[model samples]
Target: MVKVVQPAYGRVFQDDEGAAELAKVLWKETVAALKEAEAVTLANLARADRYVRAKVEFENLYPTAYQQGPVLKGEEGGEYFNYRWSACEKLNERMLKLEKAMFGEATVKAGREKPAAGKVAADEFLGPDNGIRQ
Candidate 1:
């Protein structure tokens, strides 16, 4: 996952390309969807592994997106900031609460040639791996 941390100047954008390539190793269906040059972005990649979008969204939204909803709006007005902040926090909460829905087990290996890279499968929680099983 560290390999996927691309600093977006001031903001942090999830590396969908890295994720997709990593997915091709850990995720069963990602390679098929990302087969061609689809401009590997989270939205496009989500077509294959939907949980990826959730995790990516949660990652990009926090600490700085504390950027808009609250980061910028905190000085605007508590009421307005609260609204945006709530929305932002709500998203974060969903990512946390819906960990199972957002992430689960790896179905199977997509194949070889694709190394595990620095990517962690969804099983390891924050590192990746879709869900926490019982």
Candidate 2:
């Protein structure tokens, strides 16, 4: 049998057919809902989109120093702060999931990976007697 290796696409691989089947089915219902009643999903998408837009807008508009209310004092004038997102954590959790589902699904981005464990470093010599400095 051929040996499988580490960092395959930087993610875990399904070792057997049953694991593969489970992975495929995990999102099957969500996809089916999108197909069967697309409008419902679209509405959720729309709400999520609006919230994201508002968030970005707030970031742009109210970029004042943290706890340094809008009217800045003399020393705090130069620095700016990001919008605080701690007030409604439950809403944040719900919207974050909805937003993640809308954005990061079925997409893959290339990334740099370190050399696998068995590979030798370029600086190392190949022999049992090769001394390693402490």
Candidate 3:
């Protein structure tokens, strides 16, 4: 089982098994999406990194709720609810940014390969013979 750092919600998962399973699923989906976009670069890779982080944080929110059980009449209930809500908000924000970067109007410019030496310029209308033909 993979071990992730305890989220701000604190240690929610009783064991690493659940977290590891979730992480694996997220990783596979992230990789597939990246491949489809042909965005295997370092910069785009960072987007996937953000997604994984956000997902793990979001998943921890569930375990937190489970551990707390029903929310009784107390400020603690409100606080716990607020914290989980904040986590959801943050995860949504990250996902939105990632989607925009992956499929938005932004264009990726690939590096141009230099033409080899001795290549004739296509604009050179005048041929090697140097003059207009009869």
Candidate 4:
């Protein structure tokens, strides 16, 4: 298991237990996604560290958005703010880039492997001489 560095913004959470729980969940999710990409290499894990930090920061900043509304209002002329939807979008873009780096491409390229010389095509076996109709 690779250890990810804590995000500087995570300090806002304050509760050690809550922070630990959040970290655990993030770590597991990241590991699972990396595994699915067949990219559980050390280099990929290191790349994942950045994604984890962004995710943790996002979670810390918008903790109540799921339960409440996406937008959160500030009190009495203080600094008004909304949910971190832009941050979430940025996180998604980063995830896509990471997956592409790890997994090559979303679609497999054609002719990546060529047939050996003198190999018969499978269609040949279904020809008339083999007693199979097209």
Highest lDDT: give the candidate number.
Answer: 4
Clashing pairs in 2: none
Worst 10 residues of 4 by lDDT: 4-13
lDDT of 3 at 40: 65
lDDT accuracy of residue 42 in candidate 4:
78
Error of 2 at 99 (Å): 1.3
Point out the higher-scoring one by lDDT: 2 or 3.
3
What C-alpha lDDT, on a 0 to 100 scale, does residue 63 get in candidate 1? 49
TM-score of each: 0.30, 0.27, 0.50, 0.45
**Residue 16 accuracy (lDDT) in model 1:** 56
TM-score of 3: 0.50
Best to worst by TM-score, what's the order? 3, 4, 1, 2
* lDDT to native, each model: 0.44, 0.43, 0.62, 0.63
How accurate locally is residue 37 in candidate 1, as Cα lDDT from 0 to 100?
Answer: 37
Alpha carbon lDDT at 13, candidate 2: 26
TM-score computed on alpha carbons, candidate 4: 0.45
What does candidate 4's lDDT look like per residue over 21-114, in tens digits?
A: 6765776787788777667877877666666666666666555544455456676655544446556667667867865776668775586576
lDDT string for model 2 (48-88, tens) is 44444344333433444335453333564664433342333
Which residue pairs overlap in candidate 4's backbone?
none
- Model 4: residues with Cα > 4 Å off, grouped in runs: 1-16, 62-83, 108-134
Off by over 4 Å in 3: 1-15, 62-81, 105-134
For model 2, the superposed segments whose C-alpha errors exceed 4 Å read 1-45, 49-87, 105-111, 122-134
Candidate 3 C-alpha lDDT tens digits along 1-134? 22222232223333666766676577667767767767666666666667666777677775765555544346555423445555566777887788677556666798887767755466367667545466
